[model samples]
Target chain A: MSAEAQTCPALDAKELDRLRGLCRQARIDLLRSIANAGAGHTGGAMSLVEIVTALYFRVMRVDPARPDWPERDRFILSKGHSSPGLYAALAARGYFPKERLSEFDVAGGMLQGHPDMLKTPGIDMSTGSLGQGLSVGIGMALAGRLKGLNVRVFVLAGDGEMQEGQVWEAAMYAGFHKVSRLVLIVDCNSIQLTGRTDETLSLAPLAGKLEAFGWRCVECDGHDLADLVPALERAVAVEDGPVCVIARTEKGHGVSFIANRVEWHAKAPTPEQLAQAIAELEGAK
Target chain B: MAETGLTYTVYDADHMTQAEIYGAVLTRLGGERPDIVALTADLAKSTKIGKFGEKYPERFFNVGIAEQNLFGVGAGLALAGFTPFISTFAVFTSLRAAEQVRTDICYQKLNCKIIATHSGVSFGQAGTTHHCTEDISVMRSFAGMTVIVPADGIETAKAVAACCDWEGPVYIRIGRGFEPRCYENDQYDFQIGKSIQMADGSDLTVIACGPSVQHAVEAAKVLKAEAGLSVRVLNMHTIKPIDKDAIISAVHDTRRIITAEDHSTIGGLGTSVAEVIAETGKSCLLRKLGIPDQFAIVGYPDDLYNHYKIDADGIIEAANAIMGTELEADEDWEDEF
Candidate 1:
């Protein structure tokens, strides 16, 4: 919480393991919230557990109590159906009570089915529709550069979300304007709501597309924070345009039956299914 | 103030393009306030923010031909403590960037200003796609939104200056060309939600906004001079948080009311005035004049206004039609008053 604490980014192996453990617990909480609400997106939430967890717990310089801290790094969940995942990370970081996870999608609760910055704390921009957050981040990054503020914007988007044409519009802006202090992390989970991403609309050679758009690309294991943290460091070090970290991951990472399954994109677990999934996660632990 | 090519001050604002006035004001604001910034979605030349772009090159951003991103990035800029003035065509902001304007700016209550140009049939030759008649409806529907349709160059300057420092999202719709001035000068007080009564007449009231305000004033003058009818004209520029007292005064004093705009008759100024007058349980014969249910006819803005009977002549005719059917409100509506 001091100036020295803000300067520190080196995570010991033990801290990394503890963060990983926190991610595992967040994943369980994501499932519990979705299951408790009786209907929600499970696959994308599970896919985003580690990347989001790493950003909140270790990467982003955000204090929960001061979510509006001007110097704090910003995060936007562009793929907003996965609110349970983002809520889990914000909860684990003490932005709100972890008990609020059970209230996901409950009418009149803090957690909506989608991310609403007005209703929920620690949500930088209220993003539900896809392909818009990157441009918003570009705006913030440009403002930060203009103000000479020690801040950066991180936008987490999905491969399916990239299908929207606005994403490329923002990419072109970021490239042409030479906006720095911004990182765009694409959750390259190979699946979407109705079908696999490649089957729906191919983003093959996504890195090449990003490169053409003037972004420096770094591919990493989305579920492995070790790969993500170092790649994020490289992204931060780049001084030119924005950086893109293409995180390769399955549709559902933690649980087996839901892994790479398109149908689980928005289906919640029953009580029995929750028990079975908890057993599988416990077994893996 | 900063090399504005015009000698027009607030006391003598005459014959300047509204967009030029906006550019001049922004150029001045950019010099005075470092937090003020300009953005356009490749409409710098057409929307007239190009002047500001040229003056303060570092403070202006052209995000290519993308309106949605223009709005989203405006919210982002506002979030990072900058006053972002995003300019584009009104059609794009109302339809293309509607979601971004709603979710990103209005929902979050960001301090962003949207300068939507070429509103209404002002882009008549460009056809319905370019013309924006639904912006007033869409912008007014959002809560915490300050919707302003400046009547002329003077009002546009005032509105731009007022919105640069005011909190929350503000959408100011302006026309393509020079609308005839409704005010002799910019000395009038420009508030966010208050109506400006240009003239007071007890026989009838004609409430209009944007391009229609000048015509309504011209009609009021003609009716007073030619027909011996006292037709009051109101420049109801701010649509959301509309002046209820003004409408009630119009209803109480003049039982005949006619609302006109350069927008759809359904959800724009006409409907807003009707709702206000109806809520008071007061009886008034009202003529809601604007573009009907069909798409606008292709022509110049003046020709289209005449064709749709919302021009000065048309407003005069509408006033004549409504003045005949005024019901007596002497003592029957005393309790409602």
Candidate 2:
């Protein structure tokens, strides 16, 4: 149990509406930053907007002022290439000035193409190479427990990145060890770098496989904040074993032409496309 | 032994291997520091890191058979503000999980120590898969990595304690079992990036690392007695941030240099010394004795050391060859490529 685990408070209608507003803006900001950088992982970052927003805004107990707080809940973007998504959330959450978002992958800039904990203030762990973040979260979780600190560690990984063998290695260790303070959110955004993940390497029975590996598995629509917030809270409540919330999402989630487009995996959106994306998000309530 | 600053150990120093001393030393340090943690990849017994596990089971993590996860978890533990000591075979730590070591630990500049046992061809009978002659090459290339090859169990103890205080990523490569001791005890100062002059002379210098230091010292003694040759033996334990001053001084004092190592002739102690010589533009005749660019054959470690000319007898032969050679005075370059 955590210091903040007294209650899984339900999200009020106004709160949900406000959070949805942040997620929509997060998508717009992340896309603009990617477009500004001239090269970035557009699709994956777009897919992760709500998941990252939910943690920074509602779920996790973190402070933008004290990024080094020992008792703060930790977050790791294991899908590090989707740094723009994380940066947007950090900016929206006031970790740093939102204007710094323009420098997203610029040479000599504070924000790197991947999440670097040393460089970025709010980043808990440096990650770019796939399949390393979960193990790092396990380390943080285990350390917190060892220190008797009531902290939680949340790791958001991509479906395509699951192809990496190291992911399962960490999964097995956490599951076997019953590290309950960790929550793994798999953003099942189907599309990978080349094509659909199912076409490339199917993890069709993904939930069953995770259950077999000894984790408490939960599934939900990653884009729906109401569903996702409750799923995350439920995951946080489980004290018996590690929890894996398989969040079904779509690559390039918000925009019309970019959604599920494989080429947008790492491609920068053109100026016209950015305008369209901004309009689509802003035009919504 | 009391003068060495290390407490008296129950384990017999003469009979025990470097890995055993490392395990004992780590177990002792775990008592002093609460932040210290140990990890292994199903090599707890083989690497002898299990000793620390037995002492502090709560701090120990056995990431069974997953070399990548072992390093990744070690990096993670390091991120959580605990100093993690990870152990595995030299081949796995330096080669199998190279990307994890490089990207996760070295690139991030994490305070994680890698105690890689069974380095070089020490596990000879285990075949080429277990043999790691390329570790020095691979580990030295990674940025922010400190590499050390202790000569014996005493030096291993000193190195293990020293690294606990040194920040950033460090790689300590040691042999599997019973390689003869080079030092009597840990009385001598063991500093990272500094070479220890075992026996001093001016005729020729033998720059060696790991178990090769013992062979070099013995060879120097034999060369002094029989051939009437004055030989200098330097235990170049640190590979990364190598002792450039020592190598440069050896070149200035003794114009002939013979580097011995239980690794490849390409990029171990031999190649590191060669880079120094090339950079200095000095006129020292250099000879490298090691495994001559091939997969080491299966045999006992001692037999393999002899077969590959990385033993005492091999150093004697190489010393003789260097003593008989003359340096070319001409500095004109030729494009051999």
The per-prediction tally of clashing pairs is 0, 0
CA-lDDT, candidates in order? 0.87, 0.89
lDDT by residue (B1-337, candidate 1, tens digit) is 2223323464434656788788778887788788888999899999989888899998899988888889888888999889888899999998999988988889889988899899999999999899887889998998899899988888888888878767889999999987877777655788878999998999999999998999999999999999999888899989988988899989888888999999999899999999998898877899999999989989998999999888999999998888767476457765666
Lowest summed lDDT window (length 10), candidate 1 chain A: A1-10
Highest lDDT among the candidates is held by which one? 2
Error of 2 at B206 (Å): 0.5
Q: B142-192, model 2: which lDDT tens digit per residue?
A: 999999999888788888888988889999999999878887665688788
TM-score of chain B of each: 0.95, 0.95
Question: Which 10-residue window in model 2 chain B sums to the lowest lDDT?
Answer: B1-10
TM-score of each model, paired residue for residue: 0.96, 0.96
All DockQ scores: 0.81, 0.73
Calculate the i-RMS of every candidate, to one decimal place: 0.9, 1.1
Which portions of model 1 show Cα errors greater than 4 Å?
Answer: A3-12, B1-12, B326-331
